[model samples]
Target: MNIRFDGKRALVTGAGKGIGRDVVKKLVECGAETIALSRTQSDLDSLKQECPSIIPVLCDLADSESISTALKDCGPIDLLVNNAAIAICESFFDANTADFDKTFDINVKATIVVSQIVAKGMIERKAGGSIVNVSSQASLRGLKNHLIYAASKAAVDSVTRTMSLELGPHNIRTNAVNPTVTNTAMAKVGWSDPVKVKAMTSLIPLGRFAEVSEVVSVILFLLSDFSSMVSGSCVPIDGGCVAS
Candidate 1:
C-alpha cells in the first residue's frame, strides 16, 4: 500500500534516537512535515542533519512546565506519537520510589500531557487526528526485573483506551503499539548477554527480536488514514511473544 502524508504535520516525542528517530524519518519520507522532540539538544542536532526539514522541540518530558513551554508555539499537528520513555529496570523487591516516580513521570504522565494538548487542538479545529502511544510487550506479560517499566506501559495502554473512548465522538483515534525487544542501541545493551538473548528469542515463535523499521511500520499504519476505524487497540509487534 502506498501511504502518503503530503500535507500532514506530525509531532513525535523522543525523536532523537531509537524507534522515535526511525518514526520521524519514515514520516518525513512519506511526505509529512514532522516535529521532533527530545531532551538532548545534541541528539536533536544530529537528527536535524539527517532530516533537515524536521522541526526540533527540546523538551524534557519529566518536567510539566518544560512540556508546556516547548509546545507553546508548536502550531497544530495532525498526528501525535508519544514515544518518549525511560525504563528503570529493577526487580520488584529491589525497586525504589525514586525510580518508580521517574519511570511514570515520563512514560505515563508525559504521554497524557502531550496527547491532551494535541488532542485539544484537533478538537478545536474540528478536523480530528490520530495518537499512537509507544508501549511494550512487558505491559501484556511479566518480565524479569521490569516491574516499574511494565507498570508504566500498562498505564499508557489504559490511557490509550480511555482517550479513545472519550475522543471517539470527536473523530480522534487513539491506539498503542506494544513492541518486543527491538534492536535499538538501548536494547542492544539491555539484552546483550548471549544466554539472555537465547532465552528470550526461544519464547518468540519468530525466533528473533524486532527491527526498528518493523515497529516504525506499525506506528505509521496507526497514524495513517488506512486505520481510520481502528482505535483503543494495543497492537503487539512482538513476533508472537505475547501470543505464547
Candidate 2:
C-alpha cells in the first residue's frame, strides 16, 4: 500500500486551502516536487511555512493572463490536478448572472485551459502523465439549489471523458474523482441546513461524510502507477451515495 510518486513534478490549482492544500502536501510527502497555485499570497505563504519545499505560484483561475503566466513559470508538469472550483448555495431563480459566469470560469473553463497547457508539455516530452480532475457527485445527480454548480461539474466530467479519449493515443490518461458531501469548509457552506445535511447523509450507505484524507488517498492512487490502466472514468468516493 506504499504508493510512492518519487521524483514526479506536480502542479495543483487552488492549493491555498481545503482539498487543494491537502493534495499538495500529500503529493510532496509522497516524494513529488509540487507547485501550489492560488490567488491568495498569504495562503501560499502559509503552505510554504508548513512545507518549504513546495513552490508557490500565484494564479487566479478566473484570469486568463494570470493562468498563462503561472503556467509559463511552471515549466513542465508530470501530473496535473485541476482542483479549483466555486459554488453558491441558492435557488436558480435567486442566482446572480455574475456569479454564474464566475462559477463556470473557474470550475469548467479554467480546468480545461490549464489542463491543455500542461498536457501539451506532457505529450511533447512523451511523458504520458495523469490528470485527476476534482469533480463531484453533483455531476452524477441533481441537487437542489445547485443549478449552476452542477452544470459546471457536469462539464468537467464530460471533459474528463473526452480528454481521456483524445489523450489516450498519446499515453496521457485523464480521469476524475467524484466526492460527495466531504466535511471540508467548502462543503459545509452547502450543507448548513440541518434537514438537508441529514437527508444527504441518509442517502449515503456509509451514513457519513468523507474525511479530507480519504479523498486525498483516492487522488494519490490515481496519480501513482497503481491506476496506470484506469482512465476516462469517474470514480465516486461518495460513501456509496451513488449506489443508493
Candidate 3:
C-alpha cells in the first residue's frame, strides 16, 4: 500500500507552471525521474532549479513536430501526464476559428501524438506504463464559452477509453483526471478581473477553487501502482461542482 514510484521515469507536459508543475514536483518527490516539458525556457530553468532531479525539456505541445522530436529525444518513459491545455474565454461564436483550432491542437491532437510515441516504446519493451490525462469538469458537463475547450477535452476522454482497449494487452493504462476550476495561473486569466472572479466563485458549490497540489496528489496516485486496476476512467477532483 505504499504508493511509491521509485526508479520509474515520467514525462509531464506543460510542466513549467500550474498543475503540471506540481505533478512534476510530486513525481520527483516520489522518487521518479521526471522530465518536465514546456514552451518557456525560463520556466523550465526555474523548475530545474526547484527540482534538480527533474530534467527540463523545452517544447511547445501545440506543435506536432516539436512534440514528436522532444519525446523521441527523451527516449522512453514509464509515465506520461498529458497536462497541457488551452482555453478561449470568448463566446463560441465570437471566438476566432483560429483560437478553436489552437485549443484543439494542443488539448487533443498533441496528447494523441505524444501517447503514440511513448506508448510504442512501452509496448515494444513489454513494460507496463500509465498515462494520466488532465481533463476538465467541462468535459463531463457543459459551461458557458466552453465550446472549443469542451470539445477538445471530450475528445481526450474518448481517447482515454479507446487507448485503454488498444493498449491494455501491452499493459498501458490510460486514464484521465477531471478537475473543476482550480486556482492555477490558467484560471486567473480574464477572471482576475474582480467582477469575473466573483461571478466564477458563485458557480462552485465549495465557493472556491482547488490548489494545484491537491490535483497533483490525485495524479500521483493514478500514476503509481495505487491505481493499478484503473484505466479508461475519469476521476473527478471537482469541489462539489459535479455533485451539484
Task: Provide C-alpha RMSD values for all models, in order.
Answer: 0.7, 0.9, 1.6
Q: Which digits, one per residue and each the tens of the lDDT, describe model 1 over residues 1-244?
A: 8889999999999998999999999999999999999999999999999999999999999997688789989999999999999877788899999999999999999999999899999999998999999999989998998889999999999999999999999999999999999998768656889998999999999999999999999999999999999999999999999999
Q: Give the residue spans of candidate 2 off by over 4 A.
A: none
**Model 2 CA lDDT for position 181:** 82
Worst 10 residues of 2 by lDDT: 64-73
Q: Positional deviation of 88 in candidate 2, in angstroms?
A: 1.1
* Cα TM-score of candidate 1: 0.98
Query: Candidate 1 regions off by >4 Å?
Result: none
- As a whole number from 0 to 100, the lDDT of residue 12 in candidate 3 is 96
| Model 3: CA > 4 A from native | 193-203
**Clashing residue pairs, backbone N/CA/C < 3 A, model 3:** none
Query: Which is better, 1 or 3, measured by TM-score?
Result: 1
Error of 3 at 147 (Å): 1.8
**Alpha carbon lDDT of residue 22, candidate 2?**
98
Q: Which ranking of candidates, highest lDDT first?
A: 1, 2, 3
> Per-residue lDDT of 1-244 in model 3, one digit per residue for the tens?
4567887899999998899998988888888899999999999998899998888888888789887777677866999999999877777688788987899899999999989999999988899899999998889887777778888889999999999999988889999999887888888753577776677667778888778887988898888888889999998888877777
Greater TM-score among 1 and 2 belongs to 1
